[model samples]
Target: MFLASSAKPIDDNLKNFVDEIEAQSPSLSVLAARQFRYSLRQTPVELNIKEPRQFNVLEEFIIRAAIEFQPPPTEDELASVLGLDSVFIKTTTATLRSLQTLSATSPITVTPEGRSFYEKGSVPQPPYPIQINAITDPLSDKITFQSESLNETMINLPDLADFITIDKTIADIASLPLEEIQKSIQASGLALHIPEEGKIVASCKVVASTQKIWRKISLFVIFDALEDKLSIQIRNGKQILESASNWLEVLHSESRISLQALCKLSTEAINFEREAILKQKNTEIEARIEKIRKEALETSTKANNEIDKSKVLGEAVQLRNGQISLAFSEVLNSAKSQILIYSPWVNQAVVNEKFITLLQKLANRGVWILFGHGIARRQEDEDKPVPPEVEKKIRAIKTPDGLPSVQFFWLGDSHVKEVIVDKEIYLCGSHNWLSYRGDYLPRGESVYKVTIPHQVQEAYEFLANRFQNHAQKLWENALENRDFQMAVESLCVRGALGMEDIALKEIQNNNWLELLPVWLNVALQGLKSKNLPGDSESFKTALSLLSQVSIEETFIEQLQQGWRKVIGAIAINNPETALNLLSDEVWAQFIRLKIVQESDSPNDFILYRI
Candidate 1:
């Protein structure tokens, strides 16, 4: 489950071996040595010294050992592994010894006549003489390993095109042209190594060549993008591109001289194959989904524009040129069993005429009808009169028992306008369908209707939902009005009867202390007396005259009681005058009673405080 259980131990051991190697010399790994050679190549040409791989036997052993086993190597194992055929080793040693001696002997020399030659009797080319050296100089000794020997001894493998097929990984790959261009090498056969079978799988072509300075550099190249054949590399910025019209041009003129280039091309090919398959699949899926979404949206728009009776009221009614119109009376007249109306508006006169007529007609046909009517007005019209003419017309409609079959019921009136008929026809809009607000309107108003399937449970659900939405709005408005009334009455009662501190606290919290109108209104209730030093007696006179002008005997009695307290409280310092002004009931409250301690019996009861 965890990599540390096995992988960590192997890595730790590997690190220990690498650390020991590093302590001696950091340039112990083949990759580091190769990089060293690369760095040396990048140096300015003036300091160009031949590479020195052959000079140190241990260095040669570490490099080959690193390439084979990588780490945790034993000394004997590495040496045995690196020690190739002695014949080859001896030949390389001899060449190195000769070059070392030539470099030490002179600054410049041409031939045996001018300088001693190992060949002893041979003629030499001019530049060749300047280039030739004994195998003794450390720098020249490094050269023979890279020169004639490496090139001459390296074996060239035959192309195995006949035995190749596309790798199993890309059998599903159709044609991705860009991938073909990008996938030059992987899209087709490059090469593979099958060491167990003692074969290479035609993925790479290896070749050897000697440089002008007699150093050797191997080049590996892969053919990529058959339509636009390119030389691809795995670990380099450099490449050689050539167009091959056919396979013959590749076999003949396409120079496949470097084994390294083949590795680079194979890497690029593998990466391209994987990425292309995934990208293609994603592109196809996204294209299909986008096509579906676009088609669905187009279908929805078409449906929303459709017109006909099969659609509730049809899309024609939804047009926004600016009027919502409906005519659902036809639907009501056709009802078979029952009619139910759920209009939020219960306008008095209109309900008396059209609504009552509809309900009475439906009831006469033995169809049950339920109508809700009490959407309250701004203030209570609980005792308000109905026009006699509308009332007479409504009375004309009756059931078999000769009683009014149409009834109105409502919870409250806030802001709702709706209509339902026979549970099969429904209408709701900004305007009441009856002559309701229409009676007071200056011009045109808006209305709309929705026909219900009498059989659908959503009919009752639809009305119940409308009631719930408006009920919340009504409840919120009621709470706002209640809070305002409480705040106003709270200041009136408390400021009139409370201590100064309590009144001031209420004033401060009311946030209207700075508004002179509110302060005066709140303070006026606390005046206690009407006639002060500057009194014109206007308010007192108005109260005195109004008290006698009673609209109702009960109201007059309440006013009389209020006036008695108002005058008596002003004469508080004159108890005789207050007593004379008080009525019998008022005198009963002021004729104080004493508080007697319960600790004493009737014989010794004491009046302590009153």
Candidate 2:
């Protein structure tokens, strides 16, 4: 759009380009690579012409003198009257006569055309023809002229074509500003003798135009990951465009599919690299483990001691790559109440069939799993895509109640690699437990594993707060995208972090009353888990949201029943607020009839005669 000429054919050197990128920055790597066509519009227009004045100063003076003289002086007399040489005056008059500005005979007289020309600013030249083709760059919304239209072969992918459809309206010549038209004309290499200060566009008009022609431009999306940081960038054939302000705005406005494809590409690339690296290093790692076992066995035999079969260490210990892997596996398997993980990336390589099976088992045991991944430190780095395959598999794991046990949320900005299991163990380090496979090249990666309860609890709270802080942003984005399931997941995270009021505020502000059934279910779960207080602000807001649910609104019988039960539960917590909100008749029916009352346990409520 900035008029950098058309892009050449995209090169097939993507792999080499990625290799070069990784070489320059060992921590940065490309995940996926694809080339797609963006659109540009070309419009043909006719420009009306305005020529510069053709007469010289002497010539104009002589012509004016002849027109002023009452008798219309002869060429010789005109020369004398204007105080100019007769030879020069005669020659100038001959040229003017040829141009029909003066009579061809001996008299130097202003013709009808010459009189009009003199009165209208004394111009000597007639209008000439000017027309050109202008093209609009969709990205920058700038119009420019090209000698010929872009000739790139068009692709036929309907989805991509639809994605690249130009939404900005292109202004026609009539609608275009005069200065802009002139600028495009000048850029097209039109020869105009008139100074720019002169009215160049006053004589111009859009005589004709062709239909808008759209052409393709090559574009690239790149992902960078280094030092636990992650970012996505866009590039053209020339260079990275994310650095350009205009292109940055375009990237921000690009469709979610376009951006998701970029993230998918980067993840694919990383997965490919991870596979190759592990394939080469597995043998060496196995051999090293075998050697360590042999040494331990030999030392134990000499001391006549039994080697401990349980590898679970109850004290703080530093773990390298192999130890980190074993520890991650053990933590996932041994977790009884919860599992908290913070990694900037996730890949199928780590979450394979075995991992999926373990997650299912953990879900069955009701171990709450929270996985927060993102290291986008800047504003531009937010809204990254979670790998589709990874997300699908994780979300597939459900608890006995048919609800997801794992909650995945974007941290937006976090570099800490940690895994806390059941407040009994904490792991933190440089190693990416959910993403990285040890390199083929020997590199040291370590994480400190601590069993100290206070230390583990502290780490858990830190990671949980990260998810809560970013949950609101994710919730808003999900609602905007109409991703209801993700929206629910985001709110669940807030509930888990004891920020139910924030979640309720989102529901109230976003007009999410329809989701109240699910929200109340989450609230019930929180109460059961002993996380939410009976008289918390969350209960107060719940009563307010319930007041807004229209009585005339239609709902499924089951949902309506669930809604009543949750309302009764809320009354059990905030009885005065519920009485003040609900109709007195409704309260009497619920209380006087014993329809909703405390069961054997005070906190537990049952619906008796619904």
Candidate 3:
């Protein structure tokens, strides 16, 4: 059930890609993304190898003949009895005499070594500690030496619904023809040396136990808006394989066609997720609203004169609707450093001429205001523009330094309502500051006011963080966010993927010393594409920067190959410049490329390199 299954092992890169797609109304929408486990049948197999024992076949045969004979046959008699090859018999006897296996006399006689070898029945047999390469593909029936031996511990059974129906049966690896297996093993690129004759598959036993394991694949269902067609891309391990070719080959036709049904299921899943998220949010909002209403009722029933003024800064005080407006005015007049507010909506009823005058006075006094307002349940309402006059009035406020004092933000579909003054006083409740007309009958609107230092600061920070998070989401370019390191890493990836303009622009403008790694990455990718120009300076720059980082040997080798490629290209024209660019340290390792000057043409050189 991994097909439309909700469980997907998402890496950070894929998560960011999905988030970006969700952030905008891009033409391409991801319909489905999940891991599809592929079951690989691991059947145990036994393989054998032919190895040299203490003696070879011919030597053992001669010794056995001499020992078994009634009179212990002479060399002439033995050769005549065997096949009448006297010269061959003499040569073999000479070798045996050297090994102390036969006497140096005319007739062959068993020496001590020969007697013990016959008595012990020591003869050519399949070599023990067999060098077996047991890796095989059940589908293709191709054996490989690259894989480790399969064991019982790696077995896993798949649910009927989870795995694709494989058309092929488990291949009998043990029953395969020796020649075919030999060919397959050779193709695996292992440096296995095979004898010219008698390269035997001494024994092969197909073990009864078989293992089944699953491979996790990341499946992304894509919709082409222009074509009005649905297609799929799958990440099997590290590779995002080309469509249809690897898919049909691995999963078969039935599983390939079943992907079309995912569009409906994925749509329903997204809707379900949205509704669930909204339900959780509404529950929290309702709880906060109810708490405010309950507090308002309690406060309204009590006499305002009875509440001690000295206790206000030490604890929370519930305020009635009228007191809420009075507290807001007090915050505006008494604020010293900063003011932060969150209201669900903005209207002329509250943000009137008097409110503007109070806000302006605070700005003149050097107090900064951060204001956010927006709330909606529907898409159309969320998209509705803010009141133009409200925005203009808020925008007019200026700080003592002549910079804009008011930082205005529109919180999308938010339900939070609070105000924090100088990180000292906080007011949070169900009352809307700007939208409430204050003419309605007793509606139990309440505001919770607190002046505890920690509580006020915590509330202020929470609201501030929310605004920053929202701003990041609203940012048009992801790379422009505050995280410079992440932005640089992303730029490097993009540059490596052939978006050279971005890297080039950054390089031309910024300090190259800090971006050497980025330059190296781009050069490496360019080398892979085989599209780098002979005169390009990127490769040379990357090579010069290699001493700065501790790179892997494999990476250094690849970089060296790239350097040779660039040098070869450059040597075709301006050979002297290419020669000058080559460092002695790298040149020693890359001596395969030799440039020789032509006698006839003084300035001309011929180059040969790999």
Candidate 4:
């Protein structure tokens, strides 16, 4: 509804033009009044008239302005000439341009069609004529008409004059009921037969001219009385055209039919039929496209499934740090029943927080987890203890059953790093199974994953058996060792007094050095035992007290080295082997350091300094 206007400023003459239109037509007075107000403010006016009659009035005003202006007018000049609002003039010009009645450039001029319609007072001409033939058999109840030139073309008109016994009835045709006339004709003996109820039969030979060539067409005209419409069907041809019933009514008048109106109606009918056919074709094309798309999608899905299957069964793939981590997580998440992981190194930093949470979730869903790491083979390896953080995380998992869903085992001889999920998928390689720091170091690793059921089952069984055998051997050796058995029993005593008695008895008997290995073995066992709360604080305190003793630098080095060896053995979660590495002298000094007589409580034994 926005108005556009010429850049020219408003003048006094524009105000006079507004007064003239306001006095001329009431239908245009509102626009004139709006223009007068805009002229006072020297601003462009806005017009929003929507009624058809109002548009006709506005069109007439524009035509008058076009005639008055000599060299085409600016929007303001035209508005001034017509006494219309500048905004109304702008809107009218824009609409005329869209209709191609006015040119679309500055200094707007009327188009040729506009000149004909407005300046010359011309009207739209039709494309063809409506023909009528004289009536025959006038005296009969059923009146018939035959074309003057074509005898076969006939129209069986209703005999209203005969039924009513009236004379000169054509003048009163409007008063007569066409339905009653139809009934009288149907009852008459001379009534021409029609195959359908609504159709009236007629035929004519039409000559259609294109360029200079004229083609003869034999066509039938059928009137549908129910719908009040007429259809022209070409004889022995598929093309059918329809027109309004008003065309036939014109023929019933004393005047000749308006052939121009009839031709326009015929063109409209043909255009409608073309549109329907186009719509049907579009629908068919869309359905075919949808079918093709669905087929393509189904084919693509099948091909992708085949590719995935091949990848799972193919040879091992080399992977970088990120790739290996992704592969491990993918395999772990896919586990349905159980997962077995074997790696020599395990740490909270390496295993990462995400993997830990994944383990927790899997355990909540009843998936069993078994982890194994290699036992320390050298004293230097002892520095790698089972990270206390990892143990705390494991303890935090609240499963349905009171027992932990995860189990840890130490591998004495094996160094293999692998992951097995559900006993069906196996991932084996140089990649560390538990700990992988992505892109932090230039480490090259690769792992192969296969779904070969036999190899997977064999690998799973071998690892499980190796862990079981190691645990059995450790248990048997612990039972055979008398000193180890006594140390474990003494460490199990709960009270301060019992700790004092054990510490004093060992130092007095001069067997405290033998007690050192046993005590470390018991501490490691406590860490790994599901039911035992790891007494790390006590072990740390005992070590600190032993350090306070007046031992030589070499002895101190041995003690520190022994401590690491025990921690490394425990890192692999093997307490029994860690105990075997401890010496008798180390254990003796450990007890002697805690035998201060000045200590008031048994727990105070650990608080004593040298």
lDDT of 1 by residue, 1-610 (tens): 1112132212222343333433432112111101001110110001112211222453333333333454435444433555655455334333433443122222122222212222222211122111111111111111111111212232233222222221222211112232232233222232222222222121211122212122222222222211112332112112211221132234334453322232222334434533443243234434433443353344346643453334643221321113433254665666644444544444465665566667677646534333433333322453333445544554455444233333323433323444454454544435554445444533455443443253223435544433333333333453466554334333332322222234334434443322212223332323322212113232223222332232333334333344433343434434444334334433332222111222432222111100
lDDT of 4 by residue, 56-91 (tens): 667666655665667877789877866778999889
Candidate lDDT scores, in order, read 0.33, 0.59, 0.55, 0.44
lDDT per residue for candidate 2 within 511-560, as digits (tens), equals 87766666776666555444565566665566555545565555333345
Query: What does candidate 2 score on TM?
Result: 0.40
Top-lDDT candidate index? 2
**How do the residues 491-538 of candidate 3 rate in per-residue lDDT, one tens digit apiece?**
433332234444544544443334443444444334333434545665
* Residues forming the 10-long window of minimal summed lDDT in candidate 4: 32-41
Candidate 3 local Cα displacement, residue 570, angstroms: 56
Please give the distance, in angstroms, between residue 42's alpha carbon in candidate 2 and its true position after superposition: 47
Residue-level error in angstroms, candidate 4, position 260:
99
What is the descending TM-score order? 2, 3, 4, 1
Q: Candidate 1 has what TM-score?
A: 0.23
How does candidate 1 score on lDDT? 0.33
**Model 3: CA > 4 A from native:** 1-35, 38-215, 218-273, 288-313, 364-366, 377-379, 382-384, 438-444, 452-462, 474-610
Which residue runs does candidate 1 get wrong by more than 4 Å? 1-316, 319-328, 342-359, 377-396, 401-404, 435-444, 452-459, 462-610
Candidate 3 RMSD to the correct structure = 20.4
